[model samples]
Target: MTNSKDLAREIVEGTGTEVEKGRGPSQASQITALARERYELFMSEDGRPYGVKVDGANIALPLRGKAGLRSQLARIYTDAHDGSVPAQSALTDAMVVLEGVAQAADPRQPHVRVARGDGVLVVDLGDADGQCIVIGPDGWRREQRSPVLFRRSGAMKPLPLPLRDGDGLAKLRALLNTDEDGFRLLVAWLVAAFIPDLPHPVLTFRGEQGTGKSYSAKMVIGLVDPSGAPKRTAPRDIKSWATQAFNSWALCLDNVSIIPDWLSDALCRAVTGDGIVDRALYTDDDVVVLEFRRVLAMTTIDAGALAGDLAERLLTIELHTIPDRARREEAELDAAYSDAHAGILASLFDLLADVLRVLPDVQLTERPRMADFARVLAAVDKVKGWDTLESYKATARDAVADVLDGEPFAQAVVALVDRAGPGGIVLTASELLERVPAPDRLPKKWPKDPTRAGGQLKRLAPALRTIGIDVDDSKRGPKPKKQRLYHLTASADRRCETASPASPYDPETDSDQQEEGGRYRGDASGPPATRGDAGNARGDAALFVASPQDTGPDQHGYSRGDAGDAGDAEMHPLSVPAPRTHRTPGQDAEDAPQDARPTTPCARCSRAQWNAEGSPLCLDCRTAA
Candidate 1:
C-alpha cells in the first residue's frame, strides 16, 4: 500500500501530463483535451486548490486528495478574480473556497461566517467612487458610494472634577455656606463657566480677608471640573489668558485687588453671554472670535471698586468668619470623608453619562441671566439630592439688578428725594441741609455760603446722577443768574414710584420731619417769622380774626361799627371831649394816650386829633395796630 503523500504526487503528475499532451489532438482526443484544459484553467491561482468534477449540472469538489492535488483544488475553488471565467461564476467559486478556509481556522478567534452568495468577492469602496474585490464566503459584492463624508458620533466626556476626596468637597460646601446665596450662584457660575457657547460667567466671592473666599472658590472648582480649573492670577494675567483660550474654562482668581474697568467689563460680558474676545490659536494664523464660557470665580477683599458692568453680572458670595468649633472639626475630617465618597463619585460619572445622553435635547430658554442661572441648576441637579438648585433662580434675578433700567441709583435717589421732600424739588442753598442732614448741620455759614456750599453741591451732583437724579438751572435764570434746582422728570418719578416701598426714603405722611424748621407756616405766632412782608401779615391776620362768628364784641371797638353811629361819632367824635394828652419837650404827643391832656398835634396824622379808640395812632397805625 502506498502512503497518502505518494498518491498525491502521482495524481498531480498524471494531471499535468494529460493537460499538456492533449492540447491539439484529434476529435476523440480533442474532447479529452478540452476537458483537461478546462480543469487546468480552473486551478490556476496561488494558495490551496480543490478539484471539482462537473458532470453536466452536478458539481462536486474533492474533499480528500493528495497534498498538491488538494492545494490546486483549493486555488481552483477560490479563483474569483480570474478574467477568463465568467464574472458571476468566478465569484461563486471563490466564495465556496473562502468559506471552507474559515471553517478550518481555530474556533477561538472571533469570526462571523458570511453565507454563500453571488458577487461576494467585490470590494466595498465605501462612500467614495472606486472599485476592487474582497473575497469571502459570499461572491463579489459592490457597495454604493456615499455623497458626504462620514463622521463618528458619540458624547463628549465630562470635564473631571479636581477634588479627589469627599472631605475637600465638603470643605468647599462649607465655605460656600458662608454666602447665603452661594449654592445657586455657584451653580449658575459653573454653568456659565463650563458652557462654551455662553459668554462671560463671573462668580465673585467677596468678603473681608481670611473669610475663606479663596477656599470657597476652590471648592466650586472641585465640584465643577477640577482638571480644567486654573490657578488664581493677577487681573492682567487673567485677562491675557481669557483672551487666549479658545474654549470656556474655569478660572479662580484669588486675592484680586483692583480689576481695571475694561477688564471687568470684558469679563462680565464674557460671563453674561455677550462677551467676545479676539483670539489667535497656535494652529490658526488669523484671529477669530473667542468667547469665554468659563465660570469666573474671583476672591476679592474689596468689591466696592469693581467695575459696574462686571459687578452687575457677578453672583456675589459674601463670606463671613467661621465660628463653630464643631464645624471646624468636621472640616478637619476631609480625608476620611473623601474615602467614604470615592465609590459614590465613581458612580456619579455613570449618572453623568446618562445625563449627557439626554442633555442635548433639553431646550434652554432662559433669558441670558436666567439661562446662566439655569445651566448651573442643571449641573447641580445631576448630583443626588441637590434639589435646592431652584434657589439660584432668585440669585439670577438679583445679579441682573444692575443691568435692569434705573437699578443702581434707584434706591439712592429715592432716599435722597424722600429726605429732600417737596423742598428738594426746588433746590436752593438751604435745601442741601434737608438732603444731607450732617452737611446741613455744618454751620449755616458753611454750606449756605455760595463760595463754599456751591462747590460741595456740585461735587455731590455726580453721585446723585449715578441714581438718575439730575440738577438743572432754575427756570428763573441763565448762567451766573441760574440758580440750581432739582427736578424729577416724569421718567424719574416713575422709577421712584415703581421701586420698592422699603426704600430708605419712601415717603409717608407720618414720616419724621427731615429739617428742624417746617417748610411752611401760616401763623407768624409759631416762631420768629423768616419770610413775607407786613402787607401779607395784615391780610393773614384779617382772615384769621374774621373766621370766628362769636367775636362780634371784638368788633365793637372799631370806628365803623354801624352806619347810624358812624355819622354821629364822626360829628362829635369825642365821646367826652377827646382828652388832651400833654408831653414834655422831648416827648411827642402821639406817644401819649388819647386820655391824657392834649399837648401838640399827633405826629402820625399831623392833626390836633384824639379819639376814644386812641386814634392818635394815625390812619396807618390805627389800621396796622
Candidate 2:
C-alpha cells in the first residue's frame, strides 16, 4: 500500500504542475505545499500519522516540511473539526480539503459582492466548500457555521435590528433612523471600512446622559463583530489600542470627559494620511511604527471638547432622550434580540461585500471641504442604500456653517461686555480683566499678568465697533496715555435695550435729561462757587468810580468811571461814613448839631439816623455789619 507521504507528495506535485509548466504557482500549489509539509510531520515514530484535533473533531494526517507548517496544519485540522479531529483517517482527508479551500478563498483576491437590502452584505467564496461568514456592522456573528454550499439559497442581505423585542434596542434603532441621511452615511462608512491605508477616523455620538448614546454604540458593536464584540475602552487606553495598527476592526470610546492634546493631534494625523508610531510600547530597541487603520467611534456629552481639527474629520450624531415612557418601553421591546438577529447581521456583511465589489471609483479633488462630505455621503449610499445623501450633504453644510461662522475671540469679548452691566457701561482695564470669563475658556493664549488678555480684547475692537461698542482712551491724560476702556456707545445701548423685549427702559435717559436741563437752569444743588469768580469781582470793584475819590485805573486796564466797572463795584460796594460824636444833655449843642456827621444812610436801613446815643448805629445797621 502507498504511504500517506507518497500520497501527499503526489498531490503536491499535481498542484504544482502548472507552475512547473511556465505558469506562476497557483494559489492551490502554495496551499498544497503548506499542507503536505504538515501531514508528513504528524507521523509517529512508528510510521503511523498522528490524529489532528480541530475544535473537537479529529483528523489523521501526515505532516511534512517545516516544523511551523506541521503545527499550523494540526491547528487548522483541529479548527476544521470544530476544535478536535475525530478519527486519524478522517482528519487527513479533511485537512487536505480545508487547505485547498483556504487557498481558494483568499479574500486578497477580488471576489466579494454587494447584496441588496438594509445592512446586508454577501461575500462569494468561489467553489471549494463555498463558505460565507455573515457579520453585522457592529461585528456580531451567528452561532451556526454553515457550509459554503448553503449560499445557494439566495443573495444574502442585512436586516435591520429587530426593534420590537426590547425598549433599549428599539430606542437605539429609532435614534439611528431618526435622520434618514444617517443610513446613507453608515453605508459610506462601511465602504471606507475595507480600505486599509485610511486613517482611524473618529465617529462622535454626542448627547445627554441616559439618552441611549451607549446603547446605540453597543448596537454598532453587535453589527461589526457578532462573534467577538469590541471591548469598551477608556480615553487613556486609546493610545494603547491604536498602537496595535490595523488589527482591530473598530474602536468604541465612550464617555470621554477631557480629550488630551496629544491624543487629538495623533487622531488628526492618523485620519489625514499621516500614520503614527508607538514609541511608548515598543518591544524592540527600534520604535514600533503602527498604522492606525481601524475605524474609531467615540461618545461624549459635549462635542466641543474635541479639537477643531479632529472635529472636522468626524461624523457626529446627536441623540435626543425619549420622552414618552410608553413609547420608550415599546421601542425597548422591539430591540430584543433572538438567534435570528445574528443571522440578519451575517446577511448584512455579505450585502456590504457585494456593494464594495460593485462600487463606483471616486477620485477626490483639491476641494477637501466638499470632497470630504462627498466621500462620507457616497460611502453611506453604497453600503446602507438609505438614499439620504442629500440630507447628509445638508448636515455637512451645517457643520461648515459652524466652522466658518466667526472667531471665538469675538464671541468671548461680546460675552464679557454683556456681563459688565450698564451701571458701569465703561469697562476699565482692570475691570475688563475681571469681567472676562476664565482665560482658559478663551481661545487666545493668556499672558502671566493678563497682558495678553488685553491684547486679545484689543484685537476684538473692530468686531466690537461693528456692533456699535466704542473703545475710548480720552479719559487718559496727554502723554503716555493709560489703557483704553470699552464702553457701549448710545447706539449700542439702544441696540441692547431693544434686542431683548424684556430689557428695562434706558437708564441713561434720565441722567442725560438731567444734564441737558441743569446746564442752563443752574441746579441749586450744584458744586460750590470757585475762587476765580471771587477774584474777578474784587478786581472790578477797585475800578468802579462813583462820587468818591476815584482809585483810578489800577494794574487792571480800566477807568474808575466806567459803567462796566459799576457792576463789579456793586459786588464789592464802597464803605459808609463814621458816626458823629454824641453830646451830653448839659454839654455844648455843637457836638450834637453835627447831624450824626451827615449819615448818608445806614448801609442796612437806607435812612439817615442821629448819633446822639453815642456813635451807635440802628439795630438794622448793626445786624447788617
lDDT value, residue 471 of candidate 2: 52
Query: Model 1 Cα displacement at 300 (Å)?
Result: 1.6
Which predicted model would earn the best TM-score?
2
- Alpha carbon lDDT of each predicted model: 0.40, 0.43
lDDT string, candidate 2, 1-625, tens digits: 5566755765655443333346543334444444544432233322222333233211232232223234555556567546763344333444455444443431221111221223433332222333344434444233232221111111222333322232332333443633545543554554455343344346666778766676666556445432133435454655564543233445576787667767777666656544445543334653433443346677778665554455556666666665656235535533554333544344444444555444455344433333544554455455556654555445543433343234454454555444333322454456555645555555434333446555655654543543445555355422565655545333435345433231122334422111111111012122323212211234435664445555445524532222123344334334321332444667654454443233322212223332224433444556555
How far is each candidate from the true structure, as Cα RMSD in Å? 27.9, 25.7
lDDT of 1 at 350: 37
Candidate 1, number of clashes? 42
